[model samples]
Target: MKDTFSSAAAARQAAQSEMQKVDRGAATLSQALGLGRPHLMPQAAVTVEGFKPEIDSEDWLVKSVEHTLGDGGFTTHIELERQGDGNARDQEDVEDLVNDPKK
Candidate 1:
């Protein structure tokens, strides 16, 4: 995709923002919910609680919410993703570009 921003800074910011979105969307995560999270919704930010593993506790950007009712009663599921280091160099590039557009 491509766009024409009104200014150089706007173009830089748009590129940076797109990179961030790609970073966050690089992985798909799913969490089965027990209770106490009925309010979870798509596009919300969530953090792991209940002393999960450090990696499991990283903040997530909510992608979707699912609810199911079966013989076991009701259950909720959350599909999430997180910003990743997949674009570390891209980040540095954005920084360098912002700091020195001539680069």
Candidate 2:
């Protein structure tokens, strides 16, 4: 029983070491690919006109629209931006409000 426990502990340590190496390699790869840093958000000055929102709110704005055509069919991607000085918490609140029917 003691030998089995020792072997399990050894295996765990080896797995953890391998994972650390993998993480280091991934970071190096990201740096090489010019993806080491977080992507910048769109500037506040950017705006879209004639945007119609289902919810009557002024906090959210349309950021961009992407159209794609492929064998599957046509698809549209609409990215929305929340206007505020607050952080992620504020964004989450706005998302909740937009999704809430009782709003």
Candidate 2 per-residue C-alpha lDDT over 2-101 given as tens digits, one digit per residue, 9 for 90 to 100: 1222344464444444443433322110011122212323332233334455323334433444455666465545454544333323444444433442
Best by TM-score: 1
lDDT for 92 (candidate 2): 49
TM-score, candidate number 1: 0.70
lDDT of 1: 0.71
The worst-scoring run of ten residues by lDDT in candidate 2 lies at 27-36
Question: Which residue pairs overlap in candidate 2's backbone?
Answer: none
RMSD to true structure for each model, in Å: 4.0, 19.1
Q: Write the per-residue lDDT of candidate 1 for residues 34-92, one digit (tens) a residue.
A: 75367788888877666558646676888989887877678899898885434645666
Model 2 lDDT vs. the true structure? 0.37
Q: Which candidate comes out best when scored by lDDT?
A: 1
Error of 2 at 80 (Å): 0.5
